[model samples]
Target: MRHVSGLLVLAATPIGDPRDAAPRLSEELARADVVAAEDTRRLRRLCTDLGVEPSGQIVSYHEHNEAAKTPELVARIAAGDRVVLVTDAGMPSVSDPGYRLVTACIDADLDLTCVPGPSAVLMALAVSGLPVDRFCFEGFPPRKAGERARTFAALATEPRTMVFFEAPHRIAETLTAMAEAFGPERRGAVCRELTKTYEEVKRGGLATLATWAADGVRGEITVVVAGAEPVVADLDTAVAQVLERVAGGERLKDASAAVAQASGLSRKVLYDAAVAARAT
Candidate 1:
């Protein structure tokens, strides 16, 4: 059994529009004993905008300081202080700085709660027109080109739709890498400046989206990519695909590796499938 001394509230702040702030968010900010904000300045601005002055103690809690701050916040919560955690935008802990603190509080057996508000994740998915029933969020790909390509290669065969957050400068490069690694015709959407005045959601094949992003883009970016289609049970197609890559100068090992990486099957299994395919 676990014991909790005080409530740990994970409050969601508006991603862009202040009007999207829920009523409960204001109440929580006003009533909490300690408010842990990713950016205390932003939180103060938000409070000013909402016409609510937080009577609680304010502390900065972000990626750079989360580790050091978590234990202290957990202690406060354990001491029966009502702690409310808020990020600069969207829900805390979703590609943001709230997970560690929340996990710490949980480990300390503190009562946890949330004041739900607007989320860019749900908003982008809703407008993406992609299959959202089954999906996963890949917070951010590796910043380096090679690592990013490898990461996408690993996900090529994932059956469920995938979402990713990317920086503006890297969006085009990432899309191009995805197209090359996952196939040019894979369906995807690039959502930018979600919920803001200049919001945009471009939907098309990965290759086309890559071209569109090549000209340069700005603002926050969230990409939703369609999962690879089921592997063609017909061994002929699989072998043909592998052979084409091999014929195009890719080594047999590299071709097998690439195909298998994208298709979610063992390389050995794919090699066997390729051998059987060649024999026929």
Candidate 2:
């Protein structure tokens, strides 16, 4: 039971090639009552590229001011305004702004919809050559070395293929850390400048990708890592893996949980068995 006077539209912009901009995006841009753009300058450029001029008022809406601006946008939606949200590239809210605004709209019981278009996550996964049937998008890994390593460690045994967005400058270090946590030979793909003229997809083991990226990668980066191979479900084997991780400085509880998740074993059982193994 919701009363909606207006519609909040989340529109997807082209990530690289301008031609990828959907026809409906042009219509949305032209007909919207208010256009919330992550970068107004970029929005203007996009309008020029699409050969369409936005008839609506344009306002800057990005991470820095999304919290303060979300309420206003929601109010506009409640007033029956057709508000369109667009980021610099791809769909908004994936790794960009618009999440706050979306939630605000929902809270206000305003209508919401999206003009589905290009997505870097889906694009990267599709071209990654890794199994995309079951995959998870991890967004951007932490920027700090220690934090990044710990993050990757938690997902070390993740069975679903993982996708991550990373800056060009940190791609080498991130891949190196992934190798350390996920193993040197684990397969992965580095997608760079996707859909652009310099688009490149490098598929190789984590160690190889790390080394290749050390030469310095340039452009937006999307990393797709193969999931961990399934481990034997034997309680003893699972416990041994848990103990091994604990010996390597991981907390016993974390190790137990990680192994249990990756191996389809009971966390309580793994923890108990590992404790008993240690006592002996």
Best by lDDT: 2
Best-performing candidate as measured by TM-score:
2
Candidate 2 deviant stretches above 4 angstroms: 233-280
Lowest lDDT block of 10, candidate 1: 230-239
Q: Per-model C-alpha lDDT, please? A: 0.88, 0.93
Q: For all the candidates, what are their Cα RMSDs to the real structure? A: 5.3, 4.1
What tens digits encode model 2's per-residue C-alpha lDDT throughout 1-280? 5756599999999999999999999999999999999999999999999999999899999999998999889888888899999999999999999888888887778899999998889999999889989999999999999999999999987899999999999999999999999999999999989889999999999999999999999998999999999775988778889999999999999999989987888899889899899999
Distance (Å) between predicted and true CA of 193, model 2? 0.7
Q: How many clashes in each candidate?
A: 0, 0
| Native RMSD of candidate 1 (Å) | 5.3
* Cand. 1 Cα-lDDT: 0.88
Q: How many backbone clashes does candidate 1 have?
A: 0
